[model samples]
Target: MSAPLLAIEDLSVTVRTDEGHAQIIDRADLVLRPGSIHGVVGESGCGKSTLIKAVLGLLPRRSTIDRGRILFEGQNLLTLPRESMTREVRGRAIGFIPQDPFQALNPVFRVGDQMMELLRWHGLPGESPPSRGRIDRTTRARHRAHLISMLGAVQLADAEEALERYPHQFSGGQRQRLLIAAALACGPKVILADEPTTALDVTTQLQILKLLRDLAETFGLSMVFVTHDFGVVAQLCDTVTVMYAGQTVESGPVASVLGTALHPYARMLLACHPDRAADLAGIPGAVPSPLAPPSGCRFHPRCPEARDACAAARPATREPAAHHSVACVLHDEPATATATR
Candidate 1:
């Protein structure tokens, strides 16, 4: 029927440093269907956020994407001009919620202004700027109404009062909710949320997750959420992509991957989480350096299952069943959309 909402094939991003260039995203491949929450989980420095930034063309000037095809709604994103890219996807076809809510919003502008800008950029009627110098009363009123309606959608009460307050006035959770409201205000088809709950407390984290799920369902938004925590992924996502040293190591339905992880890195990652640990003290040692990553699997040094084969060559992704896939050598069968079954 409908084609996939987003498809990333053989994606790689490189950043130039004083020494030389280093590839951060190593041929990462993934797909996101309409209204589905596909998660990218990994340790710190795993290039999870960088992947989203790449799609948005928001990578640092030093960073360059060397290879990949990012097709969004059947259009090739990388080839599209930057101005058009900003107009279409930044907030129209997609939205981005950075990990830090406090930083994402502008301290100078009122919350309403940010929302107005998003609408204006998408060319929403009545909010269009005639020029740098001029707009009338009608546009202002329409902007206010739009802002208030969006405020209500995020479960933020006192919409009118909140509009007057600057970004710093709101609590951490409220600020996050505000960002989400803005991200969804444009009716984006895809929302790239990078650790949306990391800055909030445990209770607030749960509440925000529930709100996100509710909004995603109501709006039919396909989400690409990034987080290092498995607990969050388990609760909010349907499918997952596990990354280590910037490469995907395993991907499958959340339940299957979590319960029966085939990749050595994936297993160790889950064991390290406090919520999943029974007697295991969690994996010792940190993720390898992105600048000088370990050879072959890149995770071979940390993987208990690491073998001569793993150290010799990069393991190929295996599709053992429909909808299930793993990059570890442990799985010999190739996983496909229909294979996980």
Candidate 2:
């Protein structure tokens, strides 16, 4: 319907070191609409985090984009001017909820000050300038009012008191809520949350998910939630992208991906979940290092249905149904294999 809010085509990323560059994200293709929540899931080091980070232009200093494009609202983000990108976009156009608020928030600044600083950088200058140092009293009050309302939007109580307190003063969930408030204050359309609930307790994690759902509905916010937990994706995402090694092995509507998983890697991932029935069991062996992924499917080393051909030819992504895609040859099970096994 609406133009895709974000489109990532054949994205490939690598970490550069003194020795050489090692690619961690390879050939990730994704498309998201204005209000859809797309979840990218995989075990640790599966390059789930790196894919989104590359899109946000928030890659680590050692990282580099070897190939592909990140298109946001139809503009190529990879080639946008860094300073302008950060100012007009990054936090402002697309909000980010990091996995750890402890590391994202500043210990030195008061909660409200941090919000104000972010607001000031790209804020309508005449409307809201530096409020701390001798500005028009009217402008200062307006900014403060906007800030308080934002805190209230996140359902935080005692807005004034919370503002005066530093990040450490708030609980884990509270700090995350504060980050969410800051994110909303920027008037962003999409929120790129990297395992936003990983650091919180189960109860708090659920609450945060509810908050995100509510925020998405109320603000029409599209979201890219990066997580290893399929359960979270089941609850929050409209679609799921299952990654293994450094590439997406499956992508589809959440229900289709979960209920009718086809890729051996996708099936293995679901098996790893304890809640899955015994018939649907855990995958054997640790994920191979990206420095040297297994040949062919990259999952052949552990796939139950892996065939000699699987080890010889990597299956490219193919959609058997309109919304279901898998990158494993089993989908095309040759007449011989279907008859034999």
Candidate 3:
């Protein structure tokens, strides 16, 4: 197989709290292949967004990457200089579609101007430098045309007209489409979408999902789609990584992991889905506090099949099938009978 487009290896992130430093992402590993959408599913506060922020070098001031590397196309992102990352890595190589469309765009400027400014700053092909003196009308027209074409690809109606308006002038879905257009403006190899459809209605959510999938395929883009919804993962992702508190518990091809989840937490997550459960139920117990996560197996406290050995030490990831792995002790011994009571 070809090398992964993006590889997050044994990454750990820590943040400063009132009490002390707390690790939010612990030894998390993810490998995203080119031309595929990988789903990162976990409850809120499970370090989903933290993982993405680490990849983009957008971590908060109080946060620090305590260990491991984030490699994009074999280049270590964590080691790159801040200026180099801002000028070369972000937008040009990797795009981001943040959860809140309203917060993503600046309300003070027209949408068209914002996009053109980004294009010029990134030095996208055909963008002339203002320092070289007055830009010809032809260059300005070409820039506008390029913006309209990108918006049109996102299926925005009256793309040219939409450009002249402010972000607030459009509906929630339209604003999302515009953000997506901006993300694609630089033709990135990877797109990190953090709950991009969480704020929209079900119908709009589906529409956005389809649009993202289409865009990924059209652009040969690799994507890390972070969300709490398994249904969305089932619908759009080719592979899935299920995280808890701060650890990756299960990961594999979507069909293998979803159809036959090996980890107790994975099973519980699938069982709680409305379509799978007779009654709509949620997983019992809240996520463990990141500041004081449970020792050994993070999910042992809530796992129905937890045994005494579970709390003794962290379980090593075991593979029972090709490309499928689960971080649970049940797979450690053949005599250990499975129970989900």
Candidate 4:
């Protein structure tokens, strides 16, 4: 296939706390191709969000890139200067749809004002300069028209009036759509959505999912969708990456990885999905603390198939089937041999 539009290679991020340095993302790798949605699924605190934050250069002030490179369109984002990253990378090339829409938008400001600020910053289509820091009447009209068009693209109703209200005035789903509209306003090549539908009702969640899928296809936008729901992954993603304890345990085409997951952790996660007739069962243990992750394989303590070798050393990523790779000792044997479930 073509070169990845975005890639994370051996990325590790660390944060400083009162105790000491804590490694949040450990040697994680991912690739997002053009015109496709890649799902990053894992339990909370597994570094799924941290991985995306690193990609967007939105890591916390206390955090440091301990190692690895994040490449977007052939350039290493980690090496890019802060000014360049802010001016070119953050919103223009990569858009972010935050999990909490209320928090994402300013409560005091009108929705349109926030969107207009972004449009001006990114110099998106229909943007007009303000004279002496004051927007002319004609420029304001053009911006409102552009904003309305973007709101309509996200299927938001009453686009003109919606822009005049505060974020709290809209329902959760509408707020989400507004956030999506703002993300699209910049015409980004990639949209990183962090649990964008988690807080919505079931019907609204489905609507938002459909909207995102439609937007990706219509705009040829690549998306890195961070979610815990396998149903969403199956519905929206072309490929899936399973993360645990800050590491990628399994990754492949969604069908192969979900249908025949090689890693025990992956199997456990899929087993918890309620889509199957089988009774739902959650993974046995809580995610290990990043400040003191388990030695060797982080999931060894909870992985049913983990052997003595697992605790001895971290398993290398192994490909047991075409387009499928798992980082577990079970897959270390010859491909002809079957891994014990």
Better of 1 and 3 by lDDT: 3
Q: Report the Cα RMSD per candidate.
A: 4.3, 3.0, 2.5, 2.6
lDDT values for all models: 0.83, 0.82, 0.88, 0.87
Single out the weakest 10-residue window by summed lDDT for candidate 4.
124-133
- Candidate 3 residue 23 Cα shift, in angstroms, is 0.9
Give the range of the ten consecutive residues with the poorest summed lDDT in model 3.
Answer: 125-134
lDDT of 1 by residue, 67-159 (tens): 889999889899999977877677777888889998999999888777777766564432333454244688667667877887888899999
For candidate 2, the 10 contiguous residues with the lowest summed lDDT are: 124-133
lDDT of 3 by residue, 181-287 (tens): 99888778899999999989999999999999999888788999999999999999999999999899999999999999999888888887898899887788999
Please give, for residues 1-341, the per-residue lDDT of candidate 4 as tens digits: 87899999999999999988889999998989998899999999999999989988889999999899999999999989997787678987899999987688899999988898876666654343343345657766776788899999999989999988998899899999999998888778999999999889999999999999999998889999999988899999999999998999999999998788888888888788889528979788799988899888899999776677777778899888987888887778655234333
Q: Model 1 segments beyond 4 Å from truth?
A: 125-135, 333-341
| Per-model TM-score versus the true fold | 0.92, 0.91, 0.94, 0.94
Off by over 4 Å in 2: 124-137, 278-281, 333-341
User: In model 4, which runs have C-alpha deviations exceeding 4 angstroms?
Assistant: 125-139, 334-341
List pairs with backbone clashes in candidate 4: none
- State which candidate has the highest lDDT: 3
- Model 2 TM-score (2 dp): 0.91
